[model samples]
Target: MQETIKKIFTENIQVQIAAGEVLPSALESAAFTIAQSLINGNKLLCCGTPSCHMLAQHMAGLLINFYETERPCLPAVALAQEQVNLGAIANNDEHETFARQIRAFAQQGDLLLAIAVNGNEKQIISAVEAALTRDMKVIVLVGDDGGELVGLLGPNDVEIRVPSKRPSRIVESHLVNLHCLSELIDLTLFPQEEN
Candidate 1:
């Protein structure tokens, strides 16, 4: 049992290290894009499904609250956080829950961070389309060759693909990526702070 646990941790760490090597440039670009959007008074809209949904909310909370720092709150919203709205949209439109939220809240110059381990979920694709229609820049955190979501990204958009097919490792890598991104945004926005 101890060996199994250690192996799991080792594999996760290995995947995360590989992801760090491959995804830093994309992550840096995403951080810069998010920082510029915030500096311009634009908000960040994040969305995902299941495990990714938790990550989306975590990222939003980190941005809107703080990430290892004492700074003013930044503007960010997790599209999946509103259960009532999501349930209503799911009941009514079935496939347009995230799309509806993106259409309603996202604006030009805003940023959309979409996290998907499989990267082919219908609602996330719909949200991507809606964000594009609103002229929002998109940063996708995906795994497993980026799946179909990679095809949806434009030249100006960014995709951070974790180089692993295992969903658990991919999700773990996503969490690390999210933390790195949040820290990058914090440092970029609040450079003078000692924290």
Candidate 2:
């Protein structure tokens, strides 16, 4: 059991190191986008699959509540958290669930944060398209070479592709990145606060 624990930590560290090399610029970009949206009085919308959905909600909660400091709550919503809306959409057009929610909630200049491990899911792609149609900025955290999600990104959109193919490694890296982004957003919005 001890060996297994150590092995997990070692592998996680390796993946995180690789992600550190490739993801900083993208993370910075995402933070800037999120901050700018908030500055402009725009909200953030987040969505993903079940596993990634938790991360999406986690980020929205951090922004809408507080990260590590006592600051004003930023506007953020996790589309996946709308149980009734999701169920209604699922009953009608399942693949369009997120896309429909995005259309209803997102406005121009708002930011959409989409999390995906494989990045090829149909609903994720549709959500990206919907965000684009609504003139919202998009930040996608994806794994395994970004899958089809890479092809859908526009020039202004940002994609943070985790370097590993394994889902566990990808998710671990995403959590770290999400926390880093929250800290950055907090600092960028309230630089006067003591660190």
Candidate 3:
């Protein structure tokens, strides 16, 4: 068991590193997209399952706050949680609630970040599809190659795909990826210029 755990950890690191290779640019793009949305007074919706909700909250916090920089700090420009919730609502229902809420929340110039592993959840896929239909930008943080999801999320959406091994470790890697995105978003949202 110890050896197995160690092996899993090693694989997780490799997978995380592979995923991180695309993250800097992806993070930059996501930050720019989010900042542009906020500047335009657009709403942002972030949703995932229970564990992913924790990740979402963390990302939201970072996106709405300033990171400590050597120069100075700045205020956030994005809408508050409530403001974001205005057109954004989380789907907690076991049925179609997730997809339905995502569709309702997305609007022109809005952004939706959907977190899922394997992209098997019909509701999430449907939500991404629905959001795309409305011309909303959708980003998917998926755990595998995203076979069908890749097609649905489209080339425009940033798909942060992690390797398929040790499901638990994949989740851990995702948490790390989310943290990096949040940190980058925080820095961009509250740039030192405003300070």
Residue 12 CA error for candidate 2 (Å)? Answer: 0.4
Per-residue lDDT tens digits for candidate 1, residues 61-130, read 9998999977999999998644464655468665587888888777899999998987888778888999
Better of 2 and 3 by lDDT: 2
Candidate 2, run of 10 with poorest lDDT: 80-89
Clash pairs of candidate 1?
A: none
> Taking the tens digit of each residue's C-alpha lDDT, what string does model 3 give over 34-114?
667776877667766554656666565555553344422222222122223434233243435455665555667778777
RMSD of 3: 5.5
Kindly report which residue pairs in candidate 2 clash with one another: none
Task: Provide the overall lDDT of each model, using Cα atoms, as 2-decimal numbers.
Answer: 0.88, 0.89, 0.64
Residue 152 displacement in candidate 1 (angstroms): 0.5
The root-mean-square deviation over C-alpha atoms between each candidate and the true structure, in angstroms, is: 1.9, 1.8, 5.5
**Per-residue lDDT for 109 in model 2?**
93
Residues 83-190 of candidate 2 have per-residue lDDT tens digits of 474655477767687898888778899888999998888888889999999988899999998888889888889999999999999998999999999999988989
**lDDT score for candidate 3 against the true structure:** 0.64
Q: Give candidate 2 misplaced runs (Cα > 4 Å).
A: 81-83, 86-89, 193-195
